[model samples]
Target chain A: MSGHMEITLNGQTKNIPGNASLQALAEQYTKEPTRVVAELDGAIITRDAWSRTILKAGSKVELVSFVGGG
Target chain B: MPPIAHQTAQDSFELGGKIFSSRFLLGTGKFRNKGELKASILSSNARIVTVALRRIDLERHDENILEYIPDGVTLLTNTSGARTADEAIRIARLARASGQGDWIKVEVINDSKYLLPDNEETIKATKALTAEGFIVLPYISPDLYVARRLVEAGATAIMPLGSFIGSNMGLRTREFIQVLINEIRVPMIVDAGIGAPSHACEAMEIGAAAVLVNTAVAIADNPPMMAKAFAQAVEAGRAAYLSGLPAKRPQGEASSPLTGFLFE
Candidate 1:
């Protein structure tokens, strides 16, 4: 079903389209899609493969970006 | 142009197959604003700066740090939130996948209160990451054995804490870090607890290959100016180290004869 499904994103549960890909979720989160790294479950979804990696119900997603740090 | 005396010729800092001249590696965190961060970076003239990765805030939009960082500076992405070797490696991979360069600063800290790095986990991450063709710089607590192991794990450098991170306490671990500087083959870049330009100078004076400063510069009222001070201090200390510091003496040697006065 292409209806909304709940997935854990950056620790909070979010409802997204069941057919949404990792790419879509990342683009919706960050303006700079090139600098965003998305992980499905525990595996890193590389930029090239983000569009093809579909999200599932209850799938854990982590979106990370680099920031100022020492 | 006149050449400055005591300058070490061909002393380019070669790390991970890249060359950087400045020994002051700035940490780009805790800045009041992105403009200040950019100004500090330019004023510091730091060729290598450290950055950390974190989960993107889902609720609020924040400025992109990459836009502030000027081009040509090497980005040393740090694994700060990692509590284990595996977690650190995962962060490193994600950073690389995001087009951040391969230079990873392996920081595995399990302690919440003191925030001291876990040397064992750091070494494990270094070994794994280096084997994966990464240029790893592992942060540790300045143990001689641990440093040797990190180098053996193919670490490009070992960043021993001068003191606790962001303590502004300065080189409390001077003696231990000195041991690493003397023994470790890779560059011994003193990291953490460097509060002021003087601290950076002191670390360099003790033969430290480089130093990484964050909170000190970031918290300064005039960050860009403070960064320039740190840059100058690093250079001054490097000059003193290269010029061969004088030996300590128990007895004072008089510069002039005691009988040279008019009374004589």
Candidate 2:
């Protein structure tokens, strides 16, 4: 049985697997995973638990990537 | 014996009724990692650190950088991306709501390449923030006229850039900075483009009340060592200024008059 959850990545909302870890979700978006950090509900998610964490409905997810220019 | 410290020396400055002990203010960006950043901050002995606000990530367990900073240090939120007065006002309010301090670094970078402040927008924003009960420190060009305008707009202190943001060009606007030191009654903090301890010393020698440095210390090979160097430089500069430098002379003067002994 598959469960669906509503999540907002960055500012866009989408439906995804309820048990999907942040790292798995990130993998679906981009192949380069080192520069990005996941934030769940206004808090920064540590790298160690990005893969095992499950998503919930109406959760706000932001994928912050470090960009260097200046 | 340890060198005699200046009697009137103060580690902290009072702004808007709050006191800050460390004269060196720091920025949170550009560090290689959290550990290095923490170490650098400790070495700098900065009592206040600035951080920018953005959307929070809600997907995984987030690492709050605030948790890493020592509690004694005050957090100064900045509106780095705001280009106009309206946007700056909104960001300032939001930061005050989310952060613990009423102080905001009004950074309106309209031109991304130069990262210079829009003087008109900054003046407008400073007035608005002041009316809203916020201690406004406008990051502005090293122009004495612009600094005077900022003061008229009710800015708590004027943060003049030594060079463009993150450029590491030290004291390019030394002339204007000197003018500011002579004229501005409020504290003059030399912010940005300070790449070394010598640069910081130059600013202090010219009478800058304080200096905010980040990129130089944060991006160095050994950030902690750089921080310590900055700390010593700031102290040395302040001490020199307080000790009263000797007045400049046009020509060498004989300790004993050359003609006095010959006449006898």
Candidate 3:
């Protein structure tokens, strides 16, 4: 059996492993995991739970980062 | 009457079909608390105050700052976080939806360090906002050409900063701003970097239709007292402009006339 999940990051939608947590995905994709903050369905997620929080088939997530430039 | 004197006395600016009573626009930021903010606003006699749109804490109903603002004060919602023209346009719509205000302070800052307005994005946003029937007042640097461009793009008024945002530099671009005042047909409001009431007065004396101050008044030892000082300075500046200042002379001349050869 194959598990697949759809997530939107920074306005772009992509398919990833369904069982993986947001933290693992963030660690794998982002260069600096600590600098990014994510909101799951409009609710802010704490940094510690990003990896443990399981994702469903379709979840809307927004990643906000503090950029240096104005 | 001298031309300079006649020109200096003109006060008030027409924007969004309303006349602003005071030439000093206030910002609702950096105050010790909401009560102080209200007091300062009242003391300043500023009819217009700028507010930023942010997610309200729904749980705490009493903590909202909006309730503290007194009635009859016009709140100008600013797009302080928007980095692009499109984002600013969206924020304006959201502000209108939330019943903040129809007037928008378009602030497109692409750089976080300086918080300078992105000229390209600002112009784009101004054009779009004006087209959407929103009153656009863009916060821009003291660039004479950019001020003219914004004015042409249907902005209600051109708000040129006196210096870098939050720098408290106090009219560092006096010469350039003076040029903008002389050239731009619309109301020229000097926004940002005003550290004192004297700075506000200086802006007014130099033909700025109004001056918007936030940090100076907000972070003062006594916000209310500072607001009062600003109000008086603004009024004094306006009065001086209207009364007409004496022509600058290289040296003091005797009013009694030292040389009476013609009469003799």
Candidate 4:
């Protein structure tokens, strides 16, 4: 449990350290994580706090971006 | 006041403290490609363009739509997929976090068949977003009461639908929209279901602050050309409206007097 932790990111299960920062997880998932808005569980974690926001075990995270829409 | 033959640069529309000379708002969606999107926008001379928020596709990084948007043009991110107030609020915050400015087009549509905007959710999202310092432009179904509620909710502008979204059916709710235009003090933008340049012109002629067109221009045989036509049509309609349309006559009124016609 100390070495690896399981979290759901964008509904996909991933194993990272319990103390992994949100920034690390974002970078791992998308090339443009800076442009993404991350929501941890039900609350939004702003970009400035990504480095300090730690992912806990069984956390539900969602990353979204801007695309073409009318 | 009579409509001027020429509208100077001073004639501009202000939204959320921003002044825009062009009254046309473009939607950057459904283009065949990035090049086409850029060309159509430029041709239309629309200063404000709308985009949507979605989950980034990790596999298709090259398909990122933001790269295609040019500099100097303002981007209005729309909450097109949000079916509830919370979802739309989240999308608006995410859009602002992307450094795309605080302009948000709140669209909460739960109905799929008509693709109508949910006025109740839209009002909630508008109030929430605007309170957080975002400029909210809520797209509603062109109801007088709903529009007033949105304004009370601090919406910067009210974008009432002409008909179903992307239906290209023209202004099916023209009468209701006219009512909103007359009652609402803020800018009244006609969004969605505008199929042709004529439709856009009609909306403008009826005193719409602006018209947001997408499918008509994006899916045209020549998007850039269609965009140009729409731009011209919008201007013409606005000018005609300003010039004050001639009063209608119930009976047949001939250009020449009836007594002097053939008898002379």
Task: List TM-score per model, in order.
Answer: 0.96, 0.76, 0.74, 0.92
Worst 10 residues of 4 chain B by lDDT: B55-64
- After superposing candidate 1, which stretches have Cα over 4 Å from the reference? B1-9, B257-261
lDDT of 2 by residue, B132-227 (tens): 989999988877788888889899899988998888899999999889889989899899899999999888877888888889988999988998
| Backbone clashes in model 1, listed as residue pairs | none
The candidate 4 chain A region of ten consecutive residues with least summed lDDT is A28-37
lDDT of 1 by residue, B44-127 (tens): 999899999999999887789999989999999999999999999999999899887899999999998889999999999999
Q: After superposition, how far is residue B72 of candidate 4 from its true place, in Å?
A: 1.9
TM-score of 3: 0.74
- The lDDT ranking, best first, is 1, 4, 2, 3
Q: Against the true structure, whose lDDT is highest?
A: 1
Model 4 regions more than 4 Å off? B1-5, B256-263
The ten-residue window of minimal lDDT in model 2 chain B covers B54-63
Query: Given candidate 3, what's the lDDT at residue B129?
Result: 91
TM-score of chain B of 2: 0.89
Candidate 3 backbone collisions, by pair: A23-A50, A23-A51, A69-B112, A70-B110, A70-B111, A70-B112, B8-B241, B9-B241, B9-B242
Position B62, candidate 1: lDDT: 75
Q: DockQ numbers for every candidate?
A: 0.88, 0.09, 0.04, 0.67
Who wins the DockQ comparison?
Answer: 1
